[model samples]
Target: MGSNDSEYFSDEEEAWVMYKDRSEWADITPLPQNDGPNPVVRIAYSDTFTDVYDYFRAVVAKGELSERALQLTEDALHMNTANYTVWQYRRKCLAHLGSDLEKELVFCREMIELNPKNYQVWHHRRVIVEWNGHADKELRLTEIIFSQDAKNYHAWEHRQWVLRTYRLYDGELEYVNRLLEEDVRNNSAWNQRYFVIVQTTGYTQDVIKQEVEYTKKAIEKVVNNESPWSYLRGVLQHSEKGLHSVEGLESWCMALHEAGNNSPFLMAFLIDLAEDTMECHIEEREEKLAKVLEWCESLATEHDKIRREFWRYMARHISHKYSV
Candidate 1:
């Protein structure tokens, strides 16, 4: 059965009968799997799966690029979507037969919907889309997948590929903004925002300032959220003038720290800023390093006890750096 045969019986009894009765497959001899005598482990494949793969092996060995061979591959994939060899063979058939790529894309979409996290399916979709040179449907498809699963790594990877390859920068920031509005802690959405900025206008001064403000607002909404804090550091890293270049950022961080918003990520950001300050001003190196050591101690003792060893190590490292 082809991938389009959505109504094909999945029952082993019915599928076995269906495969045996098909006259179209009479010309090809089906190859059965060989397990050596006294095999330590033997797989008990379902009847339908066995029949489909037996015929698949036969066609693959004969180097057949016929419609029936293509259908047989689809049948095998329906049984085992994770089979990389079947997907590879299907691509070869599609290429040789000059099949309708648009229809193939639809098939791929259906397969992806069925198995969103399947690496094989996503790779197949990517290859087909690259061949068809139409990435218009990708963003929407990924958005739908994201609605079902926000952190689907495959969907995020595919969406980024589509945006980068097609130069689909228009409204991408808005799309990311909507995602962030739904969940500010989504690191993927925050990363996508960074990607869009870097790929499009780059980190111009104005862009950096705009992103800093955007990240600041996000942090304001949730002081403990790490995504925006990470984004804030990333944006400022691109600035020629470093962390202090962004006006009120240092004082604001101090204010948050003093106000008892003792989030580990907030403390870490402050330590980073203090280190930056120490580097830029040799006279204040001891004082800034002392502040860094203090925060590290706080993290070790109170705010983030899980990483106590890491925080203690940071304190020692800062002390050694200043002393040397």
Candidate 2:
């Protein structure tokens, strides 16, 4: 049998028998040629998505081709939902067609139903929601995704973009409140809340309270020292609120203390934090550095190298007059 053997043998009746257990197999029983110009060559090919997608694209690029290209792409997706290239080309084709926008959105929604874990599909769904929905439709779409996966960064980022791009923060404070009530320690959600709160309402004492509480909650989520160190860096980066407060700093120090203070992770965080600080504030940081160094002293003898290095660095900083 030739390579076209399966194609010739597969009729609707036989297709079910050959492909009942293999849905990806296409019944390519040849139809009568339409007797049109540049008639398609009847080349034997596999039923794989890649082969069909390539053939569809080739025919689509031909001048004023028929709707068969779109049909072929759809067929390819039906055969293999995981074919990202097929989805990509379909997106491009839909984007260029003014009338097919709704159809495109429906197709993307189908893609999401097929594979909810696909970040790319979620992204495409976002685009469709933005185009199809009215004033608050995008937010509704975002809510749908978050409900399915509260930790989805793609969905979170998309929500942020929708709000910021549309300046839809009249409800932002409400949004932050909802997140706090729901997950309490979702860092991505917290970060978005921080951005929305600061930009929409400006930093205030209330903002400080929330961030402090968030930091505490974030610290609790960590079973190791690294998370607290990571959380502290986030606080330091966005200190519009009083995240660098004495209480917050102490909490951070306590986290390191519990991790043996001089664990390589603690030392690395401190060193990195110091590097990010300005030389002019080297003296100003000495007090906190001393506090950290004191905490480091409790480390076991085996951890001496990290403990000694940080202690020496703090001592040298205390001796300097560099002021903030």
Candidate 3:
């Protein structure tokens, strides 16, 4: 060895290494830390800026010790690298931003590796990507994360953030169309698409009209299934207009009929939709309510408990709203 190395160990650090050694899944990934400087240094609860700076200066001379400094600061600030103080300290300590940026990116990437569902870290990583390179860096990281786990909610959220922040929608909905093709059930992507369309340059009336028709056709294509209903409900939940046209409600009722009257999803949708959409003036509200009540009555003989609860809840709502 060109440079001499000194062995150091803290009791807390040793305990963690021992725990990692005993776990079966320990081989899957390298441990975050080992028997080095304690990752959790004994900093005072009310430490000042001088205290933090002095601590960094003291340990930064040793390469191994300085590496631990990043870990300790990351922990202290709870992974918020954007904090002005942490960013400044990191720049001061690392001296080379290219290496430092990579290290910071690695910390976030490691967290993404460990828990792909953490959108916050993914977002923070995007900020670093912005600082280091072009806007495309964020999308590249998002694509990498999504490739690793397609169903990762955090990754989807990160993608949406990148697109929205960049104002990256095409006029013909090309971006959304491609995204939905990736995963039709990607509600996060769908919601992002909706946001883009709503915010895009267009007359408000034209946008709303087009959105309504687009949504209607989209839901109509899948209304015979439960996922469609769930998707439709999500869309309707965000729209100011109601999805209570006799045609649409009747389509849902037909789905309930095809499902043979025992689908908890349909019943739950009916109950929640009725309550939530009461503010949306529908010419067919009473008719839709009658259809749902008829379905509940059809189930009364076989499912006494469900029927009783369903009818009681509906009756209470009706009483509160209609006064008889």
* Candidate 1 lDDT, 213-311, residue by residue in tens: 888889989999999988888888898888877889999989988998999999999998888887778889878887898899999999999999999
Candidate 1 residue 273 Cα shift, in angstroms, is 0.8
For all candidates in order, the CA lDDT equals 0.87, 0.55, 0.52
Instruction: Using lDDT, rank the candidates from best to worst.
Output: 1, 2, 3
All candidates: TM-score: 0.93, 0.57, 0.53
Off by over 4 Å in 1: 1-18
Q: Which has the better TM-score: candidate 2, or candidate 3?
A: 2
Model 2 Cα RMSD, Å?
Answer: 8.9
lDDT of 3 by residue, 89-113 (tens): 5544454424557667767676566
Model 2 lDDT tens row, 69-185: 455566656555555665666666555554366666667666654555667676666666566664355577667767787777766777777787788888776776687567655
